[model samples]
Target: MAKAFRTVLGERLRRLGKSIWWRHCTAAAFLVASLFVLPARALDNMSFVVRGGEDELTESFRAASLLVQSWNDGLTDPQTLFAAARADYGRLVGAAYAEGFYSVVVRIEIDGREAATIEPLDAPAAMREIRVTIEPGPRFTFATARMRPYAPGTQLPPAYGDTKPAFSTAIVDAAEAGVDGWRNVGHAKARVADQSITADHSADTIDSLILLEPGPRVRFGQMTISGAERMRPERIARIAGFPTGETFDPEELDTVANRLRRTGAFRSVALQEAETLGFGDTLDVDLVVAEEALRRFGVGAELSSTEGLNLSGYWLHRNLFGGAERLRVDGAIDRIGGQGDTLGYELGARIERPATPVTDASAFVEARVGREELADITLDKIELSFGLTRVLSDTLSAEAGISYIHTRAEDVTGSFEFDMVALPVSLTWERRDNPIDARKGFYLQADVTPFYGFNMTDSGAQFKADARAYRSFGAEDRLTLAGRVQLGTVVGTSLAATSPDFLFFSGGGGTVRGQPYQSLTVPLVRPSGVTVQTGGLSFAGMSGELRAGITEKIGAVAFYDAGFVSDDAIFGGNSDWHAGAGLGLRYDTGFGPIRLDVGLPVSGTTDDGVQIYVGIGQAF
Candidate 1:
């Protein structure tokens, strides 16, 4: 059994994420210590013999033989060897029972003496050979299988009944399924009242029965808060949103936890049910919260050969007003030294109040001011917005906001000014396993902003969507395939009248990697018959990557990206497309991955020697 344990432990240790390493440490600690002791070998080799069973079953017996592991690990202590052999009997029998073999015979021999007959205190200091023999009896089938008082939607395993081997695990699963079903339907204390199990050796059959006790249905009561500092108890209770006096649903506990977690005020949250029901059969739960620090700050940077270096930083106040409000201020500077691109800078601030208006919603006000100096234009802008964002489910959210914007611009043609009011609506659905380095699942986001211009600015709507999917395969999920598609269009507006910030561009690290920043642009004929470069009205882009793991923390990637830009709402008017292919390397730091990519122009007229990009997280 130790051998099987060590094998499974080795695999699990490699597969463990940092959050779960504490679970299996106790059982393996001593054995891991033994690995460094340099103990001499008592036995040269151990033999595992099975008199009757399939090849797979025989292999299972070998794995369950602790004597085999003792020899393999080169442990010479006779008492240790004897203890391991003695313990393996129960382990082997349990393994047999798991395979529907109720009657199994197991024996271990140490130097021609039956280990079961040898006394523990009489262990020899030295031994030459150790062998184990196992005979698994005929598998049993279920002659009668039944569990009573199932809830409305209970689903039992199909193999628990007739015409199949009666696995012991199936019986346990059925019992758990029955209890969970009752809990799903408001029975908060359902349990198994009685169980009867019998085996008929002569007929090679088994009979099983389980009776469930579905305790009285219940309603939810108030939540008592604990472990909170610098946060009001009333707000914590409000965010919990427990349906006091309403029929209980088991999923509500998870919902309440998520609500508090999304506020970012708590580092950890836990709910404990009362030992006894409250008055009127109400279920009261205690909410324990460990508050996060009041303040935090972080910085990030990204570099591109053509677009230069981009650096950003932010300061956060988790509990700005003792009501789970978050205040964040951030700034960014980019285009330090690029291929014809000028410096740009942006500063923004946002304040978010959680559980405002409703438990699942938050309200926020944001303000921003920025300046950009591009190859063909120089612009400055200021904006203010207020909005409500609601969490519809674990993986979906929606937001709507109204904003006022003003901009001043100087292009090659002349100078321009615009003032606009806009309403922006967005939806996001995300199911990725890890946001920073996704291994599976998909993400989708769509936004529509309709703007009303004052005098000469264009009245139009901006439509944009980004969709990404990741699929991983092979042992330990060592290979992943990731893909992304981006689409955008501006409708009810003329190309020359649209704000430069709202227009679409396809180049730099964000679109076609190997192409120069904003190099792929549409031509706009000025009133004087001269033409200048300008952003397109419509855009489409696609990126795909195949990643292979080189080690536990290192990986390699091959990717291709292509983009299209058009002057018309659709692809009817003048259009240009470009493509770039790249190979990259990644080093995972648990929090996220360090990314490095080298790109070369694959299908574009403007080809640079090569482009290098460095950043954090995946490209998408």
Candidate 2:
């Protein structure tokens, strides 16, 4: 009985193995067939060809047509290809018209049949070829052009009303220029009322008659506020400095929007003129604002070969007291590498009130404590300060402040402690196109501070000025030349009697890169026959950079910096000058550029060789 059972089991196992082999063969055959048939069924291979035009015009038309771009990539469906080609006819015609080809003709054919004559339902199941032919007819020129009712003193462009090419874009641009001419002279409601244009096919000429309505010069009406959620509406108006009851000027509205945006209180701010004129020839203004979040925080980091890694962070409250008052706390630590005891740290807090007592004026209070260890000195300090800032104009401002400081400092000379009070004043004038990546304009900053020390029985005055200019050239202003000059001086006290932080020392990333930080100083010889560096009482520095954009997101920079530090209030023959040259790479981000700079000292001590610095924004 056992032998009979074994024979039956063997027969069943044989049948099972045969069944599995058959199924495997079927699957392999099916996969092989799909490899050949799948792609042909899924993809619609179409070729697009453009003919009958100059190379520049043909390329422009092709670039403007979505159909060409799609066909170049091989569309996957016949319906999508047909739709794109049908829409491209209008786009191509418009492109020709923009170039003054008013009588141009565009023809599209699919598989030897005109696309326009074929119905969608009758289209071939698959499109194999498409051809576009363009006949850009003789260009038309303006023969007679006239615009009426412009306000007095309106200055239109010279090209306006001239026998120039009758390009569609040119006509639209002229109309806009006419409206702007009136708007510049307080006609806030100026607009194009009507336009009559006639094309003469025989002569290939166009005649244009544009009518403008320069409504009566108006004054500014009361401003209405909208879209204020967390911020008070009254405060927004006050901060905007609405020019109510004055002649309407577009520039004033721009200024108001800029001021509100600079406060960081709003995400979006728009100043719009009312749709209808208000009473007594006045134009009512509306301020539409979107407030940002009330609280924010950020962190930043930097690296330098000489200064090591530095990290900083800040916390801010935008609407601390519901009046666009800002409160911020910030902290930073530097020098992670084993660069002696040169580690440094700082913590500070500040509160600011915008539109404090008057429009365009602000008040702030700040307190800080910090410790620094440099090659020449180590300092621990605490300070309290309060200040008032006034904005005289869009590009000018002034500030005055009072501060008290207590510091304990140690140097090669010895350890000393002092208490000092300072009255500081400063003025700033800036007209740069951009604050972070300035392409054109000038900036000037001047500061004067008088300090009195109680513990050291010393009194002195310090003055400093920093001036920078930026100019751009090349296509699209892709190249920027920026130059900076800085000068500082101290009087009424010797360097030893003044606070160490108040004195000047050259050679650092901020002064003369590639050299050690605070490395250039006045030599002081002690009785022990050892010479040590002491901070200088006077300083001057100059820097220049040529920044060129290589692409939309990448740029290159070459820079040179030179600095001088002197023991006397003015430059003396013994003053030491340090200079550095460097190349930098920049990657532009939405906020600014990320910068990496490598510098080498050209005429100074550089024991560390080449120094590299990385940070955000330009060094200045």
Candidate 3:
């Protein structure tokens, strides 16, 4: 069987360089002459010369030579200097070839003697002077570019021939593209069988030919699992979904790794093919997994001027019942000192089993009890939910759940109790470069919960969507512009009948930081014909930030946020809007960023004082 295609992508970047090693002849000679006077321990200078080729090519030639770069930290030992000189001979040749120079001459000398002629084991007692010269004879243009037995529709780089500058990287790229095209079509064992690359110094031209060998189309055989502790092998295989008897695809391997890693049960997953093929010409594969610790715990805290302090923690079991099942319990307490009159607390527990009912989905069950008090409303609720989450793709996922809640509310308008049964469906798509602190890419989340109310409560559906985008510009991506838009609306339910959790509020760190928490509520008439402030039926929010990097780990940002809330479910009548603007600082902690933002209301009737928010991770 032909071997699989394998090449290091970094090999292309290893060939880097710009223009000129010496300005004038006198400077070069003077430096060489003065090197003898410098103390042996104080080796100072070297004469690096590019005798021919463009300034860019010449500069690159020297930059790619180890002997030239060693001038900065002069070699104290003779053996190291001899080794570097010998290595430079081959390194400079490859560097020249990268720039299309096929016939290049590189010479390295120590004390006027050819270092390549000296044995690497021999060391000079003391070194002061060294000389490097690279003569890139001529840049070569491609004469004939050809490849045999390539997959149909595989296109080689257009610049591979005389039409444009010939880069040696183009050859490697062509081979890779050819094999990839074959692999994409189920030829998993496709490979570069043979290659003929020749150069003509007389004409300064290159004639290239590549031959690919596509082995028999193969299917995936059974996968053998190893390195698993506490996790059941059968469950590991089920979670991997290893596609036995199906045509082999490299993407399937990646999907298996992603599935195992997503469960958080494994610290690492590695895949490899068997030494011999299985029955029916199938490729047998092996999965090696390193399971994570059995138990883990973490805690976090956040502070806000209006919302007060929030402390939260969670305990998790990665493997439960010998399967890749996850069990987590979380608790939180808030409102220690803030606008609210009393504190609120919540405790929840969830259990998730991977590869349940579907290969790409997980089954989860959750139960929770909580109390929340904000503005003129207080609610105590008990809830339960059962759901299935599916990983649709690398950057997309979806969830559908049946949720039930029993709510008791006390509002300024009146007291209400509601029992609701809802079906919530949500989809999330994200492609951020970094989730903790994104520099580019976009994120989108949209969900709808349709509910049936019992016990005299009104039935309704709630719709919400959040969209965020980030763009980076300037040198080294020093600046990033981020923006977010959020919208939510409740339909089929009146403001007085909807649960407070389903309603929208337009204040606090999460909405408008400068405004008081839940301060921008809508007024609704009660049965007594008296109007009172309450959560809105419709809401819209927008946030924009300009972030600049001041240092590797420190950053600064300026931002603006605006929110709108309305009593009408359709978002038209009796609306209130508020805006806040602020400045913030970020300290990167490797995993995420620590955030500190100070904000104040800029528009609308809201709180007048500045609000300070301290938390972990980006505000968005």
Candidate 4:
């Protein structure tokens, strides 16, 4: 296309040179063409040459080509595209003039195809190599993070501000919160203020300013509750922990709302901020609630490698007899290998009370009848339990319960009936759910069950005590070192002992780090001439395991365990110890660590065994 235009211009120039009228017409044509070819406004700042020498012109054309390519690829809107091209070309043309290029023209091609040509009418623009200089800029950090109206009161430790302390409880404890950040001042508010960091060759440090805003010291406002009555409005409100005139908090409001929701007592709850009091910026809370079905039902099915397939269903009355109470009836059918199949049923009721905004208490009672198969024994048992549980703190809790169980077992050898009754009490304390580094967090739990015959048979008074603790050494989730040890003993006229059969065995994912299930069991085969009374249970065992996280998702563990089972310390050498080590992979699912661990026995006599266990929540 350029060659054709050049040919036409050459002929026209020749004809114009021969006649004055033609010369005038040729000049006018040149001006019109110049409008199309003149460097776009963008050429002003760019460096280029229209005509100087081969080197200069080549560089200019190259630069223009690159500029055009960028424009075509980046600019989507036509107006913007044209504007950008004009500005760029205009800069380049101006730069070339400064650099002494008398004549220059820029041609644009896209995808190896020509698109447009631009140039100055009287001069050419050429761009050579460009020199770019970049210099370091000063970095900035938070100068101060502070709160308004000054944090209330003063008993708070200075550490709270110095360390940028966050609430030990859930952030929902804040005054007012929405999806992302603070919306309104609820009951209590906290924040980081005067936060600043300093870095230098000698040291680096973070300085923080923290604030707590516990909105206006106002008493509770009139609680306005709304929702279809599943029970009674007053009853639901009380269950929500909002007993009228209680000092109001946005956090408490949310907690109450959520608890009611999880009960399935409401379809939706809208807790609104309304009617404020001037004394201290307090508001009368108006909760707009929507009730769901008072009575509901659901069915579920599950398949497992060990338990096979099972179906279960439940019918629920969320607001049984009004108040914050619930009742349900459920049933299930499960099959066992070679033990035939059995059906089971149960009815249970639970009552929940929001004793406080941050605390909850509940009581539950359940009775169940089911058949279980263990080896040659086919047993049918009826069990009943009553329990009361309360949230001691966010990461700690305790519960106590009483249970009665009756079992009748039948085998080809014979049929026997047995009953076991016991009192169970347990306490669990966890700093972090599961730590990748075992040495950083602390998890301690202890449970004891002392029992007396609800019947006779092989029954005897027994006492079992178990405790485990772990600490994380690195980040909370990454465990660096951890250990667990447990022991159980029975004492009485004819009490139950920790037999090779009855001992609390510890070897698997949650126990001695490297042994398989029941590997810790003493072999039944005994040496000749050694008449051992295998019938009698014996001393309990102690297991200790150390685990270290290698990464956020991987860890190595080493462990040791020792135990003995004898009628009454028959042999001083009866106790034996086993040790092993292995590695594990952990996936953080927020809920807890999903662990996959593989281990090998280091001391015990056992086959090459691999244990694979998968379940929800944390192993500890």
Question: Best-fitting candidate, measured by TM-score?
Answer: 3
By lDDT rank, best first, the candidates go 1, 3, 2, 4
lDDT (C-alpha, whole model) for all candidates: 0.82, 0.79, 0.81, 0.45
The most accurate candidate by lDDT is 1
Winner on TM-score (1 vs 4): 1
Candidate 3 lDDT score at position 368: 99
Q: In model 1, how large is the Cα lDDT of residue 155? A: 90
- Candidate 4 positional error at 29, Å: 40
Worst 10 residues of 3 by lDDT: 16-25
Candidate 4, superposed: residue stretches over 4 Å from native: 1-216, 226-232, 246-275, 278-283, 288-359, 370-379, 409-416, 434-440, 457-483, 493-503, 506-516, 519-581, 584-596, 605-618
In candidate 2, residue 453 scores what lDDT? 83
lDDT tens readout by residue for model 3, 1-620: 22232233123223222222221123233334444433345344578888856788777877887766766555555545555676777678678767877666676778887766654334454567788877777677778878889776677677665544446777777778778778767677787887766666677777777788877788899899899878889889889999999998888889999999999998999999776677787998989999899999999888998888999999999998888889999999998787768789999999999999888999999999999985577889999999999999999999999999999888766688989999999999989998889999999999999999998678999999999999999999999999999999999988777888889998887888888888899876778887777788899999999999999999999999999999878797799889999999999999889999999899999876999999999998
Q: State the lDDT of candidate 1 residue by residue for 1-620, as single tens digits.
A: 22333343234322311222122223244444444444445566678887879999887766876766777777768657766876776677667766788766777778888776654445555667888877777888899989898899989888788757877667767777888888889888787777677777788887878788989998998788899888999888887887788887879998989899999899999998887788888899899999999999999999999878889999999999899899999999988786554589999999999888888999999999998865477789999999999999999999999999998877767888888999999999999999899989999999999999887799999999999999999999999999999999999999878888888888777887777777777887778787877789999999999999999899999999998989999655889899899899999988899999999998877677699999999887
lDDT score at residue 399, model 4, on the 0-100 scale: 77
What's the lDDT for residue 160 in model 3? 64
Q: After superposition, how far is residue 206 of candidate 4 from its true place, in Å?
A: 18
Q: Candidate 1: deviation at residue 457, Å?
A: 1.5
TM-score of 3: 0.91
- Say which prediction, candidate 3 or candidate 4, comes out ahead on lDDT: 3
> Deviation in angstroms for 302 in model 1?
1.7
**Measured by TM-score, how close is model 1 to the native structure?**
0.88
Cα-based TM-score, every candidate:
0.88, 0.83, 0.91, 0.52
lDDT of 4 by residue, 151-207 (tens): 333233332333232221111122112211322333322332222222221222122
